[model samples]
Target: MTGYLPVVGAAMSITEYDQHRDWILEKQRDLELQDFITADVLNGNWEHLAEEVLAKLDGYTGRLGIHGPFWNLDISAADPEIRQIVQKRLDQGLDVCRKLKATHMVVHSPYTTWDQHNLDQYDQGHSFKLQCIQENLGAVVAKAEDIGCTLMIENIEDVDPSIRVELVKSFNSNAIAVSLDTGHAYYAHGSTGAPPVDYYVKAAGPLLQHVHLQDADGYADRHWAIGDGTLQWPALFNALQKYTNHPRLILELANNANLPKSMRYLSEQGLAQ
Candidate 1:
């Protein structure tokens, strides 16, 4: 919405998109599709479904992003066989990106407090897990490079930004970067000792490529509209302006009904156009 960066909306499914398409078209906001492509992968027709979705969006001129298939697919799985499945899912996501000509794809991080608890399970559990992630994503990064799509690794259960930032830098590829989820950061801060939202912006800095902008009560990932929860919106915006202006800020609201309200909040606050 601003000259410095793009502000977008999130759609969890095609049905949700259809329900909110009028508002989205009216605003001409870009979108991040969460479960839309994932459902196609599960239903065994993502290729065809991707073409259908692309055709539907042909008249709607805006950038596109996809939240890849990350549910239960751990790229850093200890088992080699399981890791292969993870790689396959990511490859499928890349193929879908190629078809849709999506600008970004968000992948979930496998790190959690559980890794710290199971430290002795490996030589150095944290480092080993990071290595596993690097290896798995390294394979997919090549496809990402070939397709000219940027892969964003998002924080889910991370207690801090260090691990995710380290993972992104280790790739050292423009094709890969970091995706920060606001609600997840608050949830981690409340439950697992992660820092506040501004800390993530400062920590990620330039590597931060995309964001899932949702509000929460600091206990659960509520995914409410931007101003409806405990997050400090003004401070977060200032921190982002100081740290970087490159990340795409996406409003990932749970209920489609709240999308318009959330957009109005961003515009009224002068954070977006």
Candidate 2:
């Protein structure tokens, strides 16, 4: 179903995904991958490359997830006009996905405005920020629904997870859900005192549609392969197993020679073959 965590994966480019096509297919069969994301293919040739790669990974059967444009993609602009501009990036991303026949698209929430101090700027009457987010998001959701694609909104560290929940609640659409980023949750826990989890994923478990899993150093947002870092793999896996959310799991590991070892290490941590 849509909820089975896939442990599907990615690479630096289409050429890399093609190079590992056999491996990806073999692993998909072995692991029963339900969904996965491709690495950033921002040069606009993503459509052509994705088509070729999917044809090669024919043995693989699963859902596909795509990460929308990330560099300076201000989906949460404070300005209404600029917010409209940012929304176009997400639209373009889905246009690419529609061409590739993808089902779910992961997008980021708007960032809170911070001065040089990076303090709580929300109290500075920043509720309008959420309005901008909603306006852009509503538009994207309309497009996604037209194509029968789901928009999975990922959580950011600075924004309270509760806020994310509220945002979803505000829109109240079936076409929208949450994409919990594990590494981001870990990085959000800084010396400045952040809650363990915004409970965004756990709270919105039912609507939790996608996952991006990776191990991190508990400080930097290093997307290390599983087991190469400090995250408690067994515990996390166990929690996931019991989760009613049943979000699709994408291994979402770093692309490097270290991948083989990392994959094996995770299999030992409750992800049985």
Candidate 3:
């Protein structure tokens, strides 16, 4: 908590939270919510579980974040109708964040190689895509600002950092920032031929707000705990030190049970105290 905002993923449901409550309470860590908790926001299926979840977290005194719904929901959809749906879902997610008193929310960038190709062949295709993102996200950020929340747009299938940087900078809103997932970046490095993971942190620089700290082989998004897979952590952290003063660091492991192992690895490496 000294140099970064360290948090653990509170698994999707209250049931899952019960399983990890002991360890979470013992460690006194903050939380980054799993996608399941907010999945209903996309379909307008509110389970009214926020009050229940808040009750369970009564004693926690750390910051909270939610991984917003992104399953088949593209905010930058070219279709106006689809974009409207995207806005509705994100607005619901923002309402949830406000209810939970969570300042940071993680949202996915809708950029993909396929989309890029489709967007091409038209004059100012890239500009059109940027406009789509800016127009949609600009409205979303207005709501986020109303709720006093910041949306951290994460790279999903990004082939490079520049586009993602541009997407965030286009909004130019304090409520919009970037979230770097190390595992995703590592997997993208091989799968999409993206720059090294550290380059992303450096590129995002001051705009970097949240980080999903996990490891993965270049082949797939294994989400293995740090050090369990090959990632240049020393170099990544060294580069990160200059960019953010206290970015939220969530150990976004595939299996929440590995939180201890991941936390221990960071501590043992003197990256976290």
Q: Which one wins on TM-score? A: 1
Q: Clashes in model 1: which pairs? A: none
Error of 2 at 119 (Å): 9.4
TM-score of candidate 3 versus the correct structure, residues matched by position: 0.89
Give the per-residue lDDT of model 1 (tens digit) for 125-196: 768877888788787998899999999888898886777898888888899998899999989888888888
Off by over 4 Å in 1: 1-6, 35-43, 116-123
Worst 10 residues of 2 by lDDT: 29-38
lDDT of 2 by residue, 16-93 (tens): 555555656765521111222322454356567666756755666656656666666767676767765577667777
Report the lDDT tens digits of candidate 3 across residue range 12-102. Answer: 3455777777766776655777643345544554546677778888877666778887777877787888888778778878888888887
Q: How many clashes in each candidate?
A: 0, 3, 0
Ranking by TM-score: 1, 3, 2
In order of appearance, the predictions have TM-scores of 0.90, 0.80, 0.89
Winner of 1 and 2 under lDDT: 1
Model 3 residue runs over 4 Å out of place are 1-13, 22-28, 35-47, 115-122
